[model samples]
Target: MSVEAWTTVLVILSFIVYIYIGWRSRVSDTKGFFVAEQGVPAVANGAATAADWMSAASFISMAGLISFLGYDGSIYLIGWTGGYVLLALLLAPYLRKFGKYTVPDFVGDRYYSNVARSVAVVAAIFVSMTYVAGQMRGVGIVFSRFLQVDVSTGVVIGMVIVAFFAILGGMKGITWTQVAQYCVLIVAYLIPAFAISMLLTGIFVPQLGFTFGDIVEKLNAVQVDLGFAEYSQPFANKSMLDVLFITIALMVGTAGLPHVIVRFYTVPNVRAARYSAGWALLFIAILYTTAPAIASFARYNLIDSLHNKTVAEVQQLDWATKWENTGLLQFEDKNGDGRFQLTPEEASNEIIVDRDIIVLANPEVAQLAPWVVALVAAGGLAAALSTASGLLLVISSSIAHDVYYRMVNPHASEAKRLMVGRVMVGFAIAIAGYFGINPPGFVAQVVAFAFGLAAASFFPVIILGIFDKRTNKEGAIAGMITGLAFTIFYIVGVKFAGMPTWFFNVSAEGIGTVGMILNFVVTLVVSRLTPPPPADIQALVEELRDPTHHVPIALTDIGEEQLD
Candidate 1:
């Protein structure tokens, strides 16, 4: 079969499998809808969480970013991988022990205030919406190339598939489908990586391929000859301070992502959540370790196949022509030289390729078989849809459970809540689809914005709420509003409004670190000015910290104390 034919077959099979799983795992009650009744096994939950966390950014864009930025792209690798450690050690177990349906549930009960909960709900929506937009754009990119459709049509198709499963099965459906997606995405990812690695470096292991075969030296030499910085050199684009800030923002942002935090709630207990976190890190490492190798290989091939080639020769290449149709890759004979140029200067450069397409186009550029190309399309879809489904759940659960049930009408029935949750999913999908069709930036850049938003809005309050016994409702409310608002204003001004990067020259991508600092400082200062939390909330915080099974409050003469 041709590449498109094979891609059509594989993509259809994957979608059918996803829909069948969603039907089989359909839920009736709100508990089943929200947290899968807390019945997921540790290993299974780990796979689901891995799929959830490794969105389009990790699978399609991370390596692509590396291909384009070369060594400067390690920030994504370092910050994203290091974040799992924070999630496992600092957040997952404690939040799991709280035994809530969502992150806002914990914030609401811990701070003893609906206002705090409302702020968290809004933050969740903003972060999830921002994050899901990237995933939807990824889906559109895949369909645009593989299915030969307009990106807008592809976005609509993705919205339909995701809404069906997410609305039907909720958390229960999304979890199992994600497990299947993990298997599909990992296998699809590793196969091409192994093939390309062996072809380029004569090594089976991609990590060894990039390290032992002198591929980096060759790429560096090629890049330098083309008026670009050596591919292996660091600080080619972003400064050292900007790198540090972006790295911290992504790290804290990963740990605070509301969708990922909710994964621990699907497990049985704190122990299970811990096990799930450990397993997820292991699964995620398999891909993270292989990305740099693929990036190096892809960059070398792209330059080798196109640099100084005639316009007619490049136009005859099917892969290059198709990507151009999506407006992602283009070629022009600048200066009427009848040949393409790969120089760094924008005026003379005749080839324009979006970094987001590097990974998807790698196999085609290398002239791999049609099946390999098709499998990559399937994998890309799985990665995007898995994360999109999870984020949609977060948005729906925030509105239906956190705002509607908990605050608006505690007396709402289980069926009504479930209906409302499904309705919210439809609404969220509509919004996500719109963003998909009209994305603010490429996949990785847009996802970075989401992480920065999460870092600013949720990380400080969540950590403080867990560890600080005296963190009152006023402090939590103030911290969340200040953090989210400050981060959003900076992002909009710098990215959309052309505002100067006047704050220590930190780019909008790294401004979340500053917002996080402000959140912590404002929270502490406000907490000190206000009265402390009630005794019950304080006792709960102490109990959560206690290692024993039970810790009761004891009266110690003048002041109340915790009995460990």
Candidate 2:
């Protein structure tokens, strides 16, 4: 069968499974909708967590970034892995033991102020919307190529699919569907790697034998011959300081992400949460370690295929023309030589390829089987939809649970809350779809913005709330506002407003590290100046942070006594 036929069959089958899981796992009550009733097994929850975190960013954009950026792209791998560890060791157990339904819920109860909760809720929605835009864009890219549709139509299709499960089953449905998604995405990711590894280097092990000894040397030589720097050369495009800052931004951003943090709350207890986190790290590694190998293979293949080829010659290649239709891959013969040539200079470079398309197009570039190409299309959608669903849930939950029920109408019914949550999902999907069609940047860059925002707004407050008993509502509220506002100003001014990189030549993506530092300083200074939190809240923090407190923290007891 043709690639589209295979993709339609596989994608439809995957969607059917996801829809069925959504139906089977549907929840009416707020608890199940918000946190899966806190009953998920560690292993299942771990897989779901892995799927939730490894969005289109990891699946579609990470390898694409690495393929183009070469050595500089390793920053994403380092930052994301380090960030997960930070959350696993420092935040997960404590947050799970606190027994909250959402991050805003924790902020509200911990700080003893609805204002603090409200701030966290807004930040959650902002960050989620920004991140969801990337997922929706990924969906657009995959469908535009495989299904032969425009990017806008593809985004609408994705929005509808995500809304179905997210509105009906909530977290309960999303969790189970994500487990299945993890399986599909991982299989889809690995099979191509195995095939391409064997084809390129005659070795099936990508990580161990990825152009292992001499293949890299050959690839590097090809790069140099084309007037491009060696593929492994460090700081080819960005400065060292920028790399450090971007890495730190991504790391703390991962720790502060609301969707990922809520995964721990779905597990039964602190121990289960801890176990799930470790398992998730393992699952994430399987994809991550393979990424560089894929990047290397993709870069080499790309250079070999198009370096000195004419547009007409390249168009004869089915994959090249198909991707060209998506408008992401373009060429211009500036010198009228009738051939596209690769070069380091922007003025003479004939090809303008969107880095986002590299991974999705990798199979076709390598002439893998039709089924493999179609399977990759399905995997891209799976990765995009999985994270998109999780993010939509976070957005709805923050508004419905955090703001409406907790703050606006403390007496709302469970049914009413669920309805509001579903309604909010519709609104969020519409907004996310719009951004997908008109994204500010490519998939990975947009996601990096979201991460930086999360690092700036949520990381410091959550850290202080957990470890410091003296942290008060005034401090948290002030810190969040300061950090978030500053970060947004810098990102918008630089990215959109053409504001120069003023702070030590740090780009917008890396400015989040500075925002995080400001948040920490402002929080500490404000906390010392203001009165401390109430004695009960202080006791709760101390208890959760205790070295020997492995069991649950008995948050219900504290809630009964002082929180209400």
What local distance difference test score does each model get?
Answer: 0.90, 0.92
Candidate 1 structure lDDT: 0.90
- The digit string of per-residue lDDT tens for model 2 on 294-355 reads 98998888888888998689979988888889999988899998999888899999988898
* Most lDDT-accurate candidate: 2
In order, what is each prediction's RMSD in angstroms? 3.5, 1.6
Per-residue lDDT over 306-339 for candidate 1, one digit per residue giving the tens place of the 0 to 100 score:
9999988888999998999999998888788888
Regions of candidate 2 where Cα sits further than 4 Å from its true position: 547-564
The global Cα lDDT (0 to 1) of model 2 is 0.92
